[model samples]
Target: MPRAWTLRSRPNGMPTADNFELRDAPVPRLEDGQVHVRNRWLSVDPYMRGRMNDVKSYVPPFQVGEPLEGGAVGEVVDSRAEGFAAGDLVLHMAGWRDEAVLPATALNKLPQLGVEPQAFLGNLGLTGGTAYFGLLDAAQARQGDIVFVSAAAGAVGSAVVQIAKAKGMTVIGSAGGPAKCDFVRSLGADAVIDYKAGPLVKSLAEAAPKGIDVYFDNVGGDHLDAALAHARKDARFAICGMIEGYNAAEPMCFRYIMRVIAMRIMLKGFIYTDYLPRMGEFFADMGALVASGQVKSRDTVVGGLENTPDAFLGLFTGANTGKMLVKL
Candidate 1:
């Protein structure tokens, strides 16, 4: 029998294993216009945390006792649809399980990018897509710009660091500790701040004394404040993820709210799916970057579907340096 993980209950603060259930989920028979797949990889992302709450969001909340879903790469074992056959590789949203019978409309043949199957879950999928559109479109980062990135050693942030470097931007990245800071530096950041060591406001000022032309925010709170305080006139900011306050009980307060007015900064909040119509452009550009080796992936993989809950909890704890995945 195959298996699937379900949301047993909602969490009050940070989620625990008690909130998830791994159960026997035998694969079902394929209906017309559907394909049966054996999932090979499952993605765990920060955004999935918000979905766990039974609140209204851009996407529907995961129902209790139902299988949780995320990015997944799988192989087709059977198909009742055109353009799909056995042994075909596909990407779909039927994750948190080992096998699924899904509609053909919800499936896509993995682009012939020549990257590994798992890369689609990391650099080639949401992680890379988020960074690509967030930086270039939302932040309007240009060559010769000085940029600052929060959670610089993270999955999306790591890609942002490399992409900015490849495009000739002077980059500064902030990571929690020395090891992560070193990791960000190796991604070609001009300056790496060990945010755990000292004040970020001071760190940003020292790193880019000329002031930053762009800010890519992954962790909000102090990072947002620091970017606001350090932003030059007409600076552009892309609000990506605010992982710092995801599990917080109270609202976040920014200390440098006045900076936005003083410096005339433009803040743009975006979701990668906003560019779905523009995926051709994203693939054309990002695929070349991947081919050039300018953009690569660093992933922390947890093996087994039973460990999916642990892998998801790891996102809030900074347990992953890059992409966090469960190898199904």
Candidate 2:
């Protein structure tokens, strides 16, 4: 029997360990067009927090008592589908479990990217894709632009820093501590703001001086407010994630909403799936950047399946510098 984490109850505010129940379950027999996968790597992201709640959003809510799901990389152990074989590596959304039985249509064969399979769960997967499409397509970041990225030491934000630098942009990243700020600077950010040091708006104003042309928002609330306050005319903003308010009991209020109109800022909320039709373009460009060493993958992996819940909770606590994963 394999073990999986089942949601025992919907979270009220921040999730607790008691919300999840680990249960041993039997692996289903592979039927025609089905494959059995032994998961190797599981992704823990902030967006998953939204799904845990019973709400109508871009994706459906996670049903209580069912296994919670997210991105995962695994190796096929049994296959009844054509073109898929035993021992083939694959990426799927049947995560939060040690083993999964999924339709072959739901699995993507792993690419030989000269990186570990888990990279598919991080820099080379949705994490990187979000940064790629959000910055280049949604935010429209360009050469000579001053770009501000919030939560710059996290998975998608770090990628944004590298991609912006690769495209000849001046990048400013905001992180919580000196070490994370240093990590952001090492990723080619022209300036790194320690958000914990003082007021974000003041720090960002000082770092940009001339105001930012583009803002890649990961942490909302104060970060968004700061970006709005220091935005250049015709600035573009890509609203990717708002981890700041994810666990909040009350709605987050903003004092700089009027700045968007006054500054003529263009703010857009986007999901990577919105640009799925153009994924080939993303693969070609991001793959080249990664292979050429202009873009790099960074990760913080927690070992074992039992730690997956803790790994997920850590996303809110700044426990990871890059992509956070559980090596199952």
Candidate 3:
């Protein structure tokens, strides 16, 4: 018998460990056109938090008693599908479990980028794609522009910093503490603000004396306000995630909401899947940057399938940095 996590109950505000239930899940018999997969790495992301609640959104909400699904990398143990074979490495959306029986159509073979298997869960997968499309497409960041990225030490944010620097942009990254700020500095940001040290707007102002031309927002709330306050006219803003208000009891009220009109800002919300049609372009460019050592990646790994709930909770508590994964 294998184990999988299920949504035990929807949370009122912040989710707790008790909200998830771990139970014995028997591996189902593989039907025709199906494969049996043993998950090697499981991804935990901020977006998954929203799925826990039973609400209508971009993606459907997770059912209260069903096995939770997410991105994962696994090796095919057995396959009834024609193209897939035993021992093939594949990426799928059958996570939150130790093992899975899935249709062949649901699996994607890992790219031959010459990187580690879990890199797909981070640098080359959702996180990386989110950063690339959000900054370059949604924000319309260009060379010589000053870019401000919130959650600079995070998976998507770190990628944005390196990508911006590689393209000859001035980057001002905001992270929580000294260690995170130092990590952003290593990513070649022109300025790294320790957001926890003082007022976010004040730090951002001091970092980029000139108003920023691009804002890559991850932790919205106050970070959104700060970017709005300091945006140069016609600045483009990519609203990727608002993690700050995700678990908060009250809704976020931007103090400088009026700046959007006054500064003529262009704020757009987008998801990485919006660029799936351009997948080949992303793979060619991002893969090269990664191989050239210009773009680096990191992960905070929690070992075991049983600890998946804790690993997911860690995202809100800042318990992990870079991409957070559960090594099963």
Best by lDDT: 3
Model 2 C-alpha RMSD to native: 0.9
lDDT of 1: 0.92
| Model 3, global lDDT | 0.93
Please give, for residues 110-149, the per-residue lDDT of candidate 3 as tens digits.
9899999999999899999999989999999999999999
lDDT (Cα, 0-100) at 279 in candidate 3: 81
Q: Worst 10-residue stretch by lDDT in candidate 3? A: 313-322
Ordered from best to worst TM-score, the candidate numbers read: 3, 2, 1
How big is the positional error of residue 132 in model 2, measured in Å on the Cα after superposition? 0.2
TM-score of each: 0.98, 0.98, 0.99
Per-residue CA lDDT of model 1 for 1-328, tens digit only, reads: 8888899999888888999998889877888899999999999899998899999988999999999999999999999999999999999998999999999999989989889999888888889999999999999999999999999888999999999999999999999988999899889999998888889899888998999999999999999999998899999999998998888899889998788998999999999889989988988999999999999888999999888989989888779998898997
Tens digits of per-residue lDDT, candidate 2, 1-328, equal: 8999999998888999999999997887779999999999999899999999988999999999999999999999989999899999999998999998999999999877677788787777899999999999899999999999999999999999999999999999999999999999889999999999999889988899999999999999999999998998999999999999999978888888898888999999999789879867877888889889999978898999999999999999999999999998
List where candidate 2 sits over 4 angstroms from the true fold.
none
- Say which prediction, candidate 1 or candidate 3, comes out ahead on lDDT: 3
Per-candidate total of colliding backbone pairs: 0, 0, 0
